[model samples]
Target: MTETTPLNDIIASRIARQGRITFADFMAACLYEPGLGYYTSPGRKVGAEGDFYTSITVHASYGRVVAREIAQMWRNMGSPAGFTLVECGAGNGRLACDIMDFLAEREPVMHQSLRLVLVEQEPSLESAQREMLAVHIDSLSWLSPDEFASGSFTFSGCLYSNELIDALPTHRVVMTSDGLKEVYVTCTNGEYAEEAGEPSTPELEAYLKRVAVELHPGQQAEVNLNAPKWLASAARALQRGFILTIDYGYTAHELYTPLRKLGTLLCYYRHQTEENPYLRLGLQDITSHVDFTTLMEYGEELGLQNAWFGEQYRFLMSAGIIEELEDLERSDVSDEEKLRLRLTLKKLIVPQGGMGDTFRVLIQSKRVTAPRLLCQRRIGG
Candidate 1:
């Protein structure tokens, strides 16, 4: 209850009986287990009080910037009278709050016409989102994945998620002279250790084949089979809209560089990032940097076009964040509140030692071309 109690024990028991579990299994239990997983345990997982932090939690302005972008996107879509705006993995609803606030203040009509859906699998978090959006209860709706994935819902407008992809279950592999070997977990005297299992899943083998990149010998990397599936599902669920993904990662070319032997698997505990995911069990957060190249390419295969890609900082800047800051500076609010807002903005925009550099944004569209997006320095630009 205090830490990752029940889930950790469950995983440890599996390790005790079996030699070790696969990294994917370990992560799935740690993060998505019925009630004991880190995400479901109800501790601080998004703010400073939690084990890790996200940009939206850092500042309300982060969400405000996003809201502005969404507004622009709405206009680009011809301001559909009943456009759908879906936010999956809507953690803590902070971003939703910001966007809602922006709508109320800026585009009241669009706010009224919009249909907002917050899709979260966790009941506890769903309850939290309900509380956060109580004022807009009429416009907002909540659904579990089971409800939405039942193949009954159709959405159009925008599909957005922040820091969602990295959490998907991924198969871990280490490249050796002998070729790629999966890193599965095993039990050793009641403790868990990793051992090589098999080559790769049939789908994973084909994914690697298409990406056509070779990992350095002894390099350990994560391959997320769930990512493409998730995106594909989003594409299917969405009829005429854009799928916007924001995460940390590189293209395949940069990810599998020869100079870099270690892959992008990592863990975070009490805000300290580390390489060993086997420690602390369900108490800490485990994640892999997303491969945007995989997302762009795979999503495109599903009829989504790569609209744009850039760092979070550039995206926020392009959304007129500076003007928002200046407005806040001139507002009737107290200096203390203004200072706090500025600090939050700084945390989101600082190029080094900040979330801006740590995060990247990939925008893909369906049935539309790229609009005049701002503040992005593309890879080739």
Candidate 2:
């Protein structure tokens, strides 16, 4: 018996007009509607006090490690004079700031030729991104999601995102004796409910077929067709360079197993996980775990090489976490601060149940061959 929110009313009206909408459309309205959706609305969505915590919230060290890897990507491309780094879902620009700071200090040559394109769906976030990345304003630009994925915004250095894909609207489907049926949203006594019907797009079935996934009977799952479509757009946009995506997900095989029959759709509100997505409408953050296998497979088909994919800890360790720790130890900070820094960093690499293993990193490249990325190095290196 939750009260109807403005977003809820809007969605209900849409459903009333259209006679029920697909879950994906409902999610899009809930999370990205003009002024009241989860992301489009004005409220904190990340970090300790927000709905959920992303890797950027853990520490600056996380982004520094990613910067170290980006430097390697530049080196892999043979030190291009005009390199561009496009970061989609650039929230508050914290990660970009950390990367820019590290690049300006350590890889000055690369920084001199670098241009960063921040692509965010919410245009209002530009002000916050601008404020956070004020020091690197000379090298920054902004692009809307439509503009970034329009197959016109070309870049050359690298494109990256952290926890971006899971937030994209995804259609839900359930396996039945008859066949795969999509889960659509319908009004039941003025409350949102689910109904099984034919999929809105044939791509949902084809996505599973392409990934060689066959869900067990009665297995309910989410299909993020937008992911591959987005990747295709990313591929088309990147004339050359690499695509780095960091998020929490699994391969198609692991993701479609019978153990997880209910799929990975999750909601976050006030730092707690909520099972029902219908409660607060735009208030809670709804997300589905990404499917990395489709990314790797579809990337290959789109003329991108699957460079690397693994746990976050491995990426951080092999890339530059140890070096970051060493630098902190040699810094002017006090011993107590160093200890706190060490513990904070541990949160990024602590194995099992921690962020380290739960999250993952996937790197794909276009036109770069035999690239020697920092993530391929030994711990000390």
Candidate 3:
């Protein structure tokens, strides 16, 4: 692929004039910059033809199962009449469709109480979302932080996202034999090159201290400054509700281990993983694994009580996902529909080659009583 991305030009020119740009700048440009960035552009990001597959794209049951869990959370919150279900980074509205469809069928009362909100940043994705959700646009509202903040957004329901956090910009740093240095991308000789810069800011140093705890010498890792910011913002937006985050990542200790020397930064294009994000700047998707520990800690600091955390498979199993299958089987459904249902159920919880272990689920609540959460450790004592 040619390295002629407009985003790269803008970023490279800035780096050329300013010496070095932080990984955060690089990431933001590569993913969110105007019309040329990967996420900001009109491209298939999640699905068979896309760079990766999210649970919602894998099967509709993913959203259905998640909706059931949300219903349970609503019930735990006394089944408030004006509950909201806000889905962040809603791509193509597939998840919303599945969740609302299941809720409409099974819990019509709670479904009627639902005010669905999709908070997406990119206009292209939002346009696509509107088209995908045209039939249900009346029931759903496209929202942003400002729009969500306009009202007394004290949610009595769940605020959820899937495969969302990993896409946030992160700072990549390495502890070399010489000392700590930030990684910077530069156009050198003829191609994009990576060089070490000075130690990151004091703030970054402190973040690294926490992230690099117990890390052996020369270990490399990524710091998601945006993750905590997002959590804090979410915490502020939600006056009273649960924050459900689902993503693929490890704890801080694991992410900073010596074995992870090259860090978790990666790119995906057409379902294939690539290490050279610069090569396919606008065409591919750039992502880093999230630090679950960071998310949990920051969320708690923002008054979001840690409710539960577990592997996606365990979460699904505990949320009675299999019961949905049994119900489908027992119902007088058609043979084809039953087969599809069985296949979807298998994809969700059947462990090997399925989403069971690959994804994870974390639920945190604010101003909510400690309720027994399925598939997770007990809520705050």
Candidate 4:
């Protein structure tokens, strides 16, 4: 018999009271149910101590490269006097600190006028973010997800997130003989199990339709209705500027292919991947591959132009990774440290068995005219 966790009991009680609930709701509870969730009651959720390593954890150069692009974005917007940089899922503020460090050192003018608004769902993490971003405390601010989407808070700058959409509670669906059905969580004899049922909303079907995706019979997939909804709120908040999203995912064609029958849903615990989300309850990280097609299509409808979209390697290379490397080479660090750093940085750009091709960067702009951003530059030229 499987040992039940505190969260497992909490969830089971809810199921007993509510009968059955959509998988999305179950996932939402497992991940964001106030204090007991994996992220909410966090204990070093990122880096070597945590379940996984983000691009931010790999090296500082990745953030430096991203900072270069933001600097260009400010320039593209005619160097606005008050440019707001909002990071939606700013975990520990490492990326924000790195980006801010680069901007302060290189683009002092822009840094001087910059206001960084960190929109995080977990309130406990604000303290860690505050400490991590201590140097830039004067330029920092905070916003709840509700406040950000409330339509009262608008900004004229770039908004970005890393691996955020995938973590948003997503509805699971499977193609059936009759049509499509959503996966629901039900409790029987105090044990949780999955069952197929009518979709919680019509938007699930409409989402696939918007992306022109057709699931093969017996194929399971995740529909992140929240992704588009979040993008819509982000679009409303951004009066003029860019939305930079970095995540591991594919276009609709690749994401919904017949070969990927099991879907991209997976869990992480202490660096090990678990196929069963039910195993760890709220102790593990639950995520799925984002569908970039929906973000692009929905972004277009929101009046944002798709400025650039491609592999992370391309974005890093074209947006000043090489310059960062050159600077590293000229630094006073020992040859041994330089060699180690060089190999570490390769993980960010290598395609096979690395973050390069699997992770993608999408830049969507609103009211920005023919912006020639740094990431759009040719690799060699």
Candidate 5:
């Protein structure tokens, strides 16, 4: 290809030697291959200047809403003397800062007991996380993905991730007339291309069966083996507490419906959706929709109760966004600034072609007795 970067060349050379590489491997390299990958590069990945905006980039209100839930979680755990809050995929720690700020201000007791462990793959981001979390440094620590997944880092508190699972490399497969075949990356005319072949593992088929989804002929889908592995590790590491996950996704049936022939994998660059992941190499961010059903099912298997799973808007509204809005009215800022904040916050929960409906929140708990949460509030409450 004309735009062959270092990572691209590395990936190309590997594929040339191996004949073909699973989309997962290609994607893993594209997004996380040391210095050359997308997330490993030195540039902004979120907010107005970056590729795309997650709910955290919208406003501090989102994390504040989450902090409200975390406070409830602390109460649910009977005001534990010690609690660990591990945030995976904690990019730059902005959300963590917001949560820490809210806890210090509104839930001093919990804040005092809180131990926030920021687990991120990119070691370089720790500086940014440290800078952003300067106020809560004593309550914070860092953990590499390998260290977190090592099965020795057990804790009793909440582990959360926002839009993390969707970034894990996934195996792409299609139901063909012959059978299920994986879509592997190959070189064609000096450019990356796809080639269908037999799946590398039986788990691909088992994953579909576990979800009870049978793709239509020629329909391609992604199987995130990493998701279950991640969940299993999280379940093991969490001796007792909750796993809160927020991402854009669907239930198994909804995600693997017959209509989606090309699967949900997508690339983002400069706020635009790019269908071609082959073009940008490490420049574009690659992601897919999470499957909440699998998370629920697997959580149950791992002894974690499916506490709550629903659209982000419902979770936000039921949790505490309205109260946040009410607090805005009492702030010293002018009404014009308040209005701007309101509009920006609306993006966090606005449905119908917005972040609200597409993104989902899932909260699963382990060894928590009959517990009540703020999101359990009735619609009118």
Candidate 6:
């Protein structure tokens, strides 16, 4: 039997009062329901002790390479004196720390002008972020996600996120003989179950049309209406700068292929992949693959240009991973440690059962005239 959690009871009560709720609503509650949610009530969420590993956990080099890209972005924008670096979903501030450390040491001018605004949904994480980013205390600031997207916050520097969009609540749908039907959650016998019905919003159908996707009969897919909405807000806040998004996903054509009958919705717990999101309630992390096509298309509509889009490996390799590896070799670490670190860095760029191809990087810009980014260079050129 699946164990019941405090969030389970809260979600059950919500369903009892609201009849049936959309899967998106259930997922949002599971992930962001104040103190009981998985992320909001986190206890080490992104390392060996946590449910999963991200590129950041692999090595500091990942963020350093990203930092290199951001430095180049600063130069591309004429090195604005008051550049603000905003990181949405800044978890524990590890990446921000690494980036700031690199800039402080190497790109001192840009670092001097850099102001990092962390936008996190969980308020309690601010302490952890502050502690992690203590060295750059003067450069650090915090903002709630709502405030960051409220149209009041504007910035003229790069905004970046790693593995963020996939966590936003996604509406699941299945192609039935009748038509596209939304997956809804209902409580029966005090347990959660799924039922398909008319979509709660017409935007679901319009989303598929925007991507030109047609699901085969009985094929299940997740429509992330929230991703585009988030992009819209990000675009609105960027007066003249770039948005760098790194996450695991595909273009709309690859994501909604008929072969992938079951959508990419997944649950992660203790490093194990769970097919059943209903089992753990808020204890496990539920996420779906981001759709880059929608981000690109919707970004254009929001007056942002798709500057670059490619796999993580290509971005890292072209950006600065090789130089980072060379620096590791020049360092005074033991030979065995160097080899170990080399292998660890390989995990970030190797394809075939690795994070390299699975994760993608999207760079979008606004009001930048022919902005040339490091990731746009030819690999090995």
- Model 1 over residues 1-381: C-alpha lDDT tens digits? 223456656887777776566677888887888777768676778777887888877777777878887787787788889978899889878788888888879999899888889887677887688888888778888777766666677888888899888888788887788877888876554455678767547665667766887777888777788888788778888888788888887787877677667678888888899777767767788888888888888887889888788778888877767868989988999999898878878778778747777788898888865665544434224
How large is the C-alpha RMSD of every model relative to the true structure? Answer: 3.0, 0.9, 3.2, 0.8, 0.9, 0.8
Tell me the whole-model lDDT of each prediction, alpha carbons only: 0.79, 0.92, 0.78, 0.93, 0.92, 0.94
Write candidate 3's Cα lDDT for 1-381 as tens digits. 336766767776777788666777888888888788888887678888787888887777778888888888888888889788888888788998888888888998998767888987675677777777676677787777556545545455789998888988888877777777788877753366767888557666777666556444666778788888778778878877799999988777777777888888899888888987778667788889888888887787788888888788888877766766767888999999899878867776666546776677889998888766655532221
Q: Model 3, 352: alpha-carbon shift in Å?
A: 5.8
The TM-score of candidate 6 is 0.99
Lowest-sum lDDT 10-residue window in model 5: 1-10
Candidate 2 lDDT over residue span 15-104, tens digit each: 888897889998999899999999999988998879899989999999999999999999989898879999989988999999999999
How far residue 357's Cα lies from its native spot in candidate 1, in Å, is 1.8
Candidate 6 lDDT over 97-200, as tens digits, reads: 88998999999988887899999999998999999999899988889999987899898999999999999999999999999999999997677889999999
Which residue pairs in model 6 clash with each other? none
Instruction: Write model 4 residue lDDT over 1-381, tens digit each, in one string.
Output: 235878888888888987799989989988888998888886888899999999999999999999999999999999999999999989899999999999999999999989999999999899999999999999999999999999999999999999899899999999999899999998777677899998889999999998888899999999999999999999999999999999999999999999999999999999999998887788899999999999999999999999999999999999998998999999999999999999999999999758999899999999999999999989956
Clashing pairs in 4: none
Pairs clashing in candidate 5? none
Q: Name the regions of candidate 3 deviating beyond 4 angstroms.
A: 145-154, 211-214, 331-341, 350-354, 376-381
**Model 4, 230: alpha-carbon shift in Å?**
0.3
TM-score of each: 0.92, 0.98, 0.91, 0.99, 0.99, 0.99
Candidate 6 overall lDDT versus native: 0.94
